[model samples]
Target: MADIDAIVDDLDAERADLEQVVAGLDATLWRAPTPAQGLTIADQIAHLNWTDELVMRAIRNPEAFADEFEGVLAPAHAVESISAGSAIVNAGTVERSKVPQSQLLTMWRRSAAELSGILRALPSGTRIPWFAPRPLSAAAMAASRVMETWAHGQDVFDALALTRPPTGRLVHVVRLGVRSRDFAYQLRGLEPPQEEFRVELRAPDGGTWNWGPADAPGKVEGSALHFALIATQRLHRDDSDLVARGEGPEEWLRIAQAYAGPVGRGRERQRPLDAV
Candidate 1:
């Protein structure tokens, strides 16, 4: 794993970039449409901010999470109620579920700050608890933060007609994403791929990230941010700057996921960035 300091720096930089974008946005754009299905830009930010808090809750007190974990995990979208939404996403639902611009902005602002502080203050050597049937190290937990911030940032940029310059630490998130390919495949109840696949990415500071068994036969390479975006399904293969070369490259790219959990049949790709 990369040094914790480097990871924190990457996380902080992305957080700062996102804040700058939201700070200048008018109220109308707070809930503006994005490429993410029916979700507004506000919903994207709320998902990141809320999920980060939920992840932290598990890390802070693993045992407590077990008490109500199953019920909350039942639905990934369109929760039965705001109360259920809050319970599952570790957020207070009524406040976050509002449609008004002010409420959405407040939700994004406050949650972003709290999420940043949680990841930033965690001791370098700590191992955070993951959702289920998985062991998580401090590095893994931090990587999830990187992945979420980058993935959701894609939403804001897609909505704002903005572009995100690739960052070096993205290599870390990309690597995690590559390594999770089999898990993504399995999420659909398919047999895991047998042959190893190479995934190469550039780090935020211009380092390279590679993952897969040493002897893997093929490779995927490009800007780390693009690779991360593609894997998270935030950017489609054609829209992203990343490239995949191999027999199943396109298919693999289509299904990749990095976060820890039981991956559901993934959400379908949204329309072109401009269509929204």
Candidate 2:
């Protein structure tokens, strides 16, 4: 059976963590641009607000995507494009920090509460929609939320240079990401390589590190944090402690993307993160 409550709890924990970071931000720091172009720290948080709300809306009306999902790549494309467009409009009109830090935190808290209520009220095993790799279950939706929140949380942490101990939760996404490796490559409009690569991630607790194809020779082993950081594209391949034992590692690293939807190259910033 899928663990529904646990997945929901992860979202709760994620919201609390986000509140901790944003509630205490210095105004100037909040205004600082994050890795995403044209989005400052505050804008990112606001975007999160919009997204979480949309997830609730999706739950309420699962058929919203039904009519327009007929064309090639229509489903995922429509969803992602609409989402990206919403953020653009918000950026153009909404203040990055719309509510005060305290109130913003409060608003998020309430918003998440609403989402939780909506989710709990849903029938389990509901066929929620997503693009590529097929439609997902309600449980899968929860997991995706965990991945989204955790990945974006990494952005806020990187902005503040605030480090938190790694969580085993991250390993789940890395494993899922590897399983979806073909989709990631396809998003780049490329065929996935047939040769599998060994993937190893050291657990935060120093337990057995888990990873990719068991029979593959070349191994990429690193701390769970590094694996998560790179998989989420928060850290560039070469910048993290990630090391490929041989050729396969480099090949895999070149197109790693933890998030779903169409794949895009990681942006190169004006200054190297290491240098800044």
Candidate 3:
């Protein structure tokens, strides 16, 4: 059985961390540009707040979400390429940018807390509507939300040259990264490698987390922070301490993406972290 309770707790913890940081920011800090081009810290929070509302809709009204999503994307689809999706996002964020920073932060906190409650209220094994190839269970949906919050929070932290300490919460992210291995390959139109790969990470609290077959020929071993960094595309694989043993695992690390959406143009290599 999925520890749905634990997933919700972790989600709340992730939200709390981000909320605390964002709440402390003044207007200048909120307006600072993140690592993502053309998006400020306010844009990140706006995006997350908007996404939380969408996730809630998916949870409570799947048909409505599907309808609204189609309408929102209809204009972009006419362009005939994936970049259209980016256009949709850019437009939405630009519109959301009108909201004041303090208001956006409040919206984020309330929406995130509401999302956690919705996830917790769902019965065991309830799958929610999502943009991923398949629907997600309540637990999976919560994990996805946590992953997004953490990754985007990293971007905000990087933009401000502030350190967001790693926590065991990232175990959720690394686990998602491992589970999405095949999805990552499929996103690039490549066949997923047939063999399983072991993934082992040293947690922030001196504990080890392992996934996949222990004796698998391929393996990814490293700090959870490194794995999460690459998986989120914030840091290139070479920039991290992750060691991938064997061709399959190496490739996985190189192209790993733990979130859904059209593939992102990852952070460029050799860029200074503070420069972001």
Best by TM-score: 3
What is the Å distance of residue 156 in model 2 from its true position? 1.5
- The digit string of per-residue lDDT tens for model 3 on 184-270 reads 887787899998999989999999999999999999999999899899999987678888899999999988989876677888787
> CA lDDT of each candidate?
0.66, 0.67, 0.82
**Against the correct fold, how does model 2 do in TM-score?**
0.81
What total of clashing residue pairs does each candidate reach? 5, 2, 0
Enumerate residue pairs that collide in model 2: 199-211, 199-212
- Tens digits of per-residue lDDT for model 2 on 63-181? 76543333422454643553454444355325535766566666667767887666666676687654434666776777777777787677777677788667767755676566766
lDDT of 3: 0.82
How do the predictions measure up, each by TM-score? 0.76, 0.81, 0.90
Give per-residue CA lDDT, model 1, range 1-276, as digits (tens).
456656767777877888788766776887688776556777766677667667768767867764556444333321232235344553443345465656665766676667666766777566654453354666676677777777778778878999777766576677778778777776656677688887776676777777776566767777777677767776666666667777676678777777654333444445676864
Query: 1 or 2, which is superior by TM-score?
Result: 2
